[model samples]
Target: MPVYDQERAGGHPGRPLIQNQTVRIVVIYAIFGLAWIYGSDHIIDLLIDDKGMLLQIAVAKGFVFILCTATLLYILINRLLGQLAAADRGRLENLENLSQKNAQLRLFFESAPASLAMFDRDMRYMEVSRRWLSMYGLGERDIIGLSHYEVFPEIPEYWKECHRRGLAGETLREEAEEFRRADGSLQYVRWEIRPWYQAAGEVGGIVIFTEDITERKRFETALEANERFLRLLTDHLPGLVGYWNGDLTCGFANRPYRDWFGKNNDEIIGSTMRALLGEELFLQNEPHVRAVLAGEPQHFQRTLVKRDGETAYVWSHYIPDLVEGSVHGFYVLVSDVTELKRAETERQRLEHQLQQAQKMESVGRLAGGIAHDFNNLLTVIMGLAQLGMRELGAGHPTLVRLEGIQHAAEKSAALTSQLLGFARKQTIAPRALNLNGAVEEMLKMLKRLVGEDIDLAWNPGRDLWKVCMDPSQLDQILANLCVNARDAITDIGKITIETGNVSFDAEYCNAHFDFVPGEYVLLAVSDDGCGMDRETMAQIFEPFFSTKEIGRGTGLGLATVYGIVKQNNGFINTYSELGEGTTFKIYLPRHTEEGARPLPEAAPAPCHGGSETILLVEDEASILNVAVSLLTLQGYQVLPAAKPGDALELAQQHRDRIDLVITDVVMPDMNGRELVRRLLPFCPKVKCLYMSGYTANVIAHHGVLDQGVNFISKPFTMNDLAAKVRAVLDAKGEAVD
Candidate 1:
């Protein structure tokens, strides 16, 4: 039977011979027979009074003894059978009590929360809890009555040894066990085995208690993986990162932090913040650290100096780690923002430059518009005065006055030219020229302009590149820059003019932001004088903006230089420091073609009389009258008209051959080009010369004369008109000058 069997009832196994009811009854009857035989012989001897009745007495005695013995046997058998029946009833009650206790024990084992099972000494499954079966993913039928090895054939030898030790009355417990199930999945289990004892205190079987902790183990693994990934991410970041405990000691730091401080993790992990950051920085950041420790997040920007002696701008963030409403530690995050700050500053500077350029552009347009109209009025005044001087001659008293009037008008016209220069509207005559020779030629004039106290130095470049620009404009640029230098000097100062070749590549252009990538001729003018500050430099290009005191300057000098440079597709850069000096660098595009020879100065041809009829058109009354009168005095028959329609009528009525047609460029009735187009039908071969104060956009592109167009700028003398008219007539094809 099993050691812990529930079938054993309350009883002892050993028995005594005297306790047998049948044996005891047989002994009693034997004793009684012996005693009765003896007693009957004695009674017969004592009663011998009647010797004759002796045989009858003996037979009576035998009958009486038989009866007595039979009765005794009957009574003893009945009493013994009654006692045996009572004992059987008591044994039945005890068996029923044992059965109830067995049922209760089975219920307790099956209802346990933990997985439990019992195996006999033979290792066969004796009992299993519902939880044990469910935990092993098995039914009751699968494990009950089966041997431990048969049920879990893949169990490790170690576990089999544990079972053996348990059966030997030793208890075994394992906090963690890796059990590889039959389906190839691993299960984490915590289990214990102990020997179950019988009522006699002997070892019976082993009982196992197990708890599945697989989910908890999986959670731990995932948490570790996530921690490793986060560490990797923070280590590679460009910004410094660290964690600090409440005691102000660093608990962790990423790669950037280690590199910046020139320390490894071993040296830094437990170091105090004050030691790592130094005394100064630690004190500077103490308040923010305190705020974080008080459970408030802190953020600020500061400059951190590295171990290499370089400084970095950082945006620092400290986020407190809170646990159960108490401060634990803080996390540090830093971002390098040095480059971003620099870019923002550069953007603001460029925006300011753009605003200044736009302001100059608006002023230029306004000044150009006014100068154009001013030139027209000066043209009429100069023409009438010059025509009067020709008619009066040198002998007349009015001749001197008329010459003076013409001189004043000519000066006024020069002033208008300066205005147009500032406006970037002056007519340009571009041609290839060598810069070195040009600078050499201007040195004498520049010396005179700067005065004797100031010295002028000309450093001409060798084998300089030729540039396609107007020589007159080049002279203007040099003159303005020199004059500005002269004014800036308070005492003896030196002005240097230099010429050289420079090449700009894409990378340089990108850095400068406003330069074109090409080869250029550099013209730099430097002055050892009172230099300008940044505020003055920014406004220097604006029209009429001057640093000189009132009445000493017109303020158009540098403005004109800026306009001319831009008009010629060049750029200018200026560098200056207060009390140091100033230098202006001008870069003009280099022309690939060979330069042309400088034109020789031409003398004016003498005005002579012509007999051919002339048709002259002018919009201004005074200009038209003076032109007609001057041509008539020169022995040509003149036809004057103020409007294009009147000129057309005059052309039709004139039967004689018209030798020339001089017309004003801009008129209400029609432009000079259109007038010529219509009148050519009447005078097919007549030479035409178009004259204007300034050529408008309709007849010229950006103040440059159109190709094959015969044009002369206004405010001309009588000699100029005569020469231009004759030149137009002399040309075999279309005339440009």
Candidate 2:
């Protein structure tokens, strides 16, 4: 029999010993019974055969021995029952203790907050806590004994290697790992795996603890996306972009910003702004940046050097990038403004030049008006002088002196005409004329004007359209331009005059300022002479502004051409460069009915004086007296009035005697035409002769005389006035009023 230790069974040691004594008693009883049985059987047989009292006595003794042995066996049975009860009680106590310990361990593993799992050496799930099962969308029944592949089939190969490493006694603690769930969803987990150790310190299994880190992973992903977007935006931006930390250090810079600083990202990052841009430019911009970081928005201009060692001007804006309503850092945005500033300066210069030109033009008009009136007076004086000289003998010294005086007055008159042309007030009689024919007529004169060394060329286009312009003005324009070209040439050069009909379409018109789309007769003059610069070209149309030295050329030449061309509803363009030639193009509108010709010129005939009396009205008493004297000399009875009112009174007094009414066009009270209307009813047969020292409004307004009315420009000679008076009186005498 194997002896059991009572302490090991959780029972007292004395009870086990008492149980052993009872077992010893039961063993002695069994041994005695077997021996008595053997002896009784043999002795009983011998006593019966020999009839001996001793044999009967031995049999009875063996029975008594058997009875005693039965008694002892009963006692041994009782003791054996007690020892069996004690052993059963100790075994039951041990089972109860084990059940209590198991309940405590179950409570601990089931309620743990951390996801807990147990894996076998093969990386198969042996046990998993409730948290681990819930996390993986699994029940214990479905996951237990399942391989990692069965639970998560989509795990990456690297994850499998990690699992293997953990099972091989290597601990793995990865901060982030992606796990695919049974529902086909992904989870980010931060986990630690440690090998489970046996009592002997050998690896048995693996224990894993994991945490869900999906929100943190999402945050990181969003941060990366924003960074990538910012980088792409800055890469394609048009100007420099950068970021500065609170310490005025460069924290981030785009490609353009880095290039502007003559550095790369690595060289600029974490560097002070002063170090990147050098002390000069950095110090200049430092205050602005500091202001921005101090929560004030700042905008200013700065010049920065580029990687190619060139400087560029920029309009820069420094704005604070704020956090929690406080200045954190600064963001810089820059744009190039050099061209805009240059354009503004150029505009101001042009405005100043325009103002000067306007002032000179105004002065020229004033001087021209004065000269026009004075020239008319000189014409009268000169004509009188000529007449006096003719009356005197040619041998007389007084006649020669008078001739010299008349010549000087005539030259003064020509000067005044040029002045009037420059002022755009000169009388123009425009008619339709062929441009080709005009150029042909100018060729001879142009050749002489350009000098002997310079060649004159004409490229006249066939079938060129005719333009309506004054022929004399065209001649002057060509002469002035030729003279300018001659002066520009230092050596032998060529001047070309070209004429053609050009149709300006919309495209061409748009390119040329103030040009209209239409059929135009183009007159182009080009010269192979030293050309003028932009400054000279701008002032070339200004009166008194000339490149020629004193007395060589009048600055009024080009100004007169400009005024004439503009008055003709034409456009002029010039192209020239230094050391190159110059070209001037004059575009005049084409006239549709250019083939029509003017009526034949009437020959001047002798005016036959009549006995008819003439009533002459004049504003100036001297002109009225002079005219009366001249008409009396012509043998016409003259009645003169100093004013239109007096003239009307004279007409009424001699209604039948007054055959004609001669009056000044401009008067302080009534004009000549108005005076004529008033006198017409009183003396219906009277014809009118309108005269003025200035061109009458009726005649000069349209550059022509009114039909059936005679006009005499003032400062006329005595004979001119007499002839006009005689013609009016004679014509009225023939009329049957």
Candidate 3:
């Protein structure tokens, strides 16, 4: 039936050798028997003498021959028996070894972890392992002797072909298939079908080894779905997110990372960190990267310059990817904080500005108080000196000394005026005036002031907006700014004066606290000269805070400009860099109106005596005495009082008409405006001239002269008093109300 059985049954080398030995033995035995028979007969014939004796002798000899022949046959039979017994013992030993090997193979097949089975060439199961029966939900008795298709009728043709191939001497391994069992359960099986050969090299059967891989396949599917979800999450995040491997090569990058770096996913993935970030950036970040890879988390801020040369602030965090208590790689998260940083910077700037403003306000109040007290004393001193000068005629020797005293007092008064300006207490008379025309008029004076070496560049805007500010105040602003510009330049440089119409919006005003939203007249004075540092700029508007050498400056120039601008409801901004240049831009609210022709310049006021009856009220005794004497000498009837109550008494006693009342604005008994209000009930027809060392809110509103109110600043000489008194008496307007 089988090639191996046929070979063993006929003409085998060992069988032929055994046959030859048996034939030889048979021939030898036959020869020995023949010789014994013939030889014994001849011996019997020779040994016998008489017939009777010969018969007896022949019988004995024949018996002996027969015994010898029997002995030889017994020997041959014993040899044959011994040979057969040894052969039988060897055969029994071989059979016992084969049986032991078969038992071992059966144990191995049943104990296998994988489902293993053996089938004949006919595809019938020869044997099945316990694992195979368990895996396929079958019993060994049910599967053995059954064909594969018979055991599972739903087996696909591909699998059947695989079985056929195995039986045809082919070996198949690791073919995965979804196998449906008879019980209606499905299994993902990866199996190996190998043809097992007999000793003669012919395919006798096949051994199929199967593994259930359903769980493994399901796990792979879940893993893929999770990966896709993770990718989607990272891609949609606003921050730049990425993962790096142990080699510092990028394993994955989010959409932001790719877009920000101006690269695609394919270019970023698998690229080294150093390669993706240029060498400079890589070097900057190398330490952080190393630290993260060393299992330490890192967070820091960096400034990135974009392709358009714009700067951006980024906050980055590098978190190490820890696996099994060791570092595998790191994760990167980057967020743009440029706007946040800018807002913070702006906040700091505004805070500094507010502090400076508060400081200036405090200092200004102190300066104003000092100036007010000093002005009061100077008023008494100057008033007495003027009286002395008038009494001592031009021919008198002491008249020259009185004039000197008068000049010194006048200089002190000028200093006080500067203080008032810095304090924003000086009265201003505003009129709508074109700035361009004003600048043009100042061009000549500026040229002479800055000297020939310094170039003057004046670019005045056409159709400039009219500014409602005191013309004298404008002159002071321009003069002081030009002088400062001149002093800043150590060598030949240029001074530029530019005028333009500009507007500030709400956003700009929000950033700069002092700014307001309106159309403005922009006056910018620029100089290519030595600039101030931050410390100097911070104190620039403070009174007597000068950078110049001692005695070279009073430091009130810029302070006065600051006061004037603020009083006019304007803002000033400065831009400067050390050793580069400086620019001061003043923004004054524009006055919207049709341009008017310039007014005719009026001749200077002539000092003259006023004959009108006047009430003079002064808190200081010296000022009171001097003013009464000065007016008495000028042929005017003067009622003098040291306080408001005394003045009220004098006014009531004087039944005659008192043409005017000259009262100190700040007095101990009462303020001038209140005194005026009270005195007005007594003498309703009396006009009042309010005088103060410094302008006060009683007589003025926001350092501006109230309309129809007559006022004068103190520290006046006889000439100033004479001119003001005459002008007030001659005025053809309604009496002070």
The CA lDDT of each predicted structure is 0.79, 0.75, 0.79
Model 3 Cα lDDT, one tens digit per residue, 486-573 = 9999878778787876655553355456777667788888776787888789889876779999998998899899988998989888
When summed lDDT is taken over every stretch of 10 residues in candidate 2, the lowest stretch is 695-704
Q: What is the lDDT of residue 732 in candidate 2?
A: 35
Candidate 2 lDDT over residue span 1-737, tens digit each:
11223356455644666667766875786677677777766766765666676667777887798689778778777767776777667657755665665555456558776687777777788667787777876764577788878877777898788878887879889899877766778889999988887556778778888878788899999999999999989967878888988887888999878766667788999998777777887778878877887899998886766667666678999989999998879988888766777678778967976897688678777867788787778978898998898889679879878988898897886677677778888766799899888878878878877778987777787898888888888988898888887888888876777776656545334544697866778787777677788878888887777988888876788888898889888988876666656777788988867366753432323555556687878877766777777677778788878887788778778898877777776577866667777787888766777775432332333233364457765444444566767665555343322
- Candidate 1 lDDT over 381-409, as tens digits, reads 88898888888787999988888888898
The reply for model 1, stretches above 4 Å from the true place, is: 1-240, 250-288, 299-316, 334-359, 377-419, 431-434, 448-455, 461-468, 480-496, 500-562, 570-737
Per-candidate count of clashing residue pairs (backbone under 3 Å): 0, 0, 0
Please say which candidate is ahead in TM-score: 1 or 2.
2
Error of 2 at 30 (Å): 48
RMSD to truth, every model: 29.7, 30.6, 29.8
Better of 2 and 3 by lDDT: 3
Output the TM-score of candidate 3.
Answer: 0.38
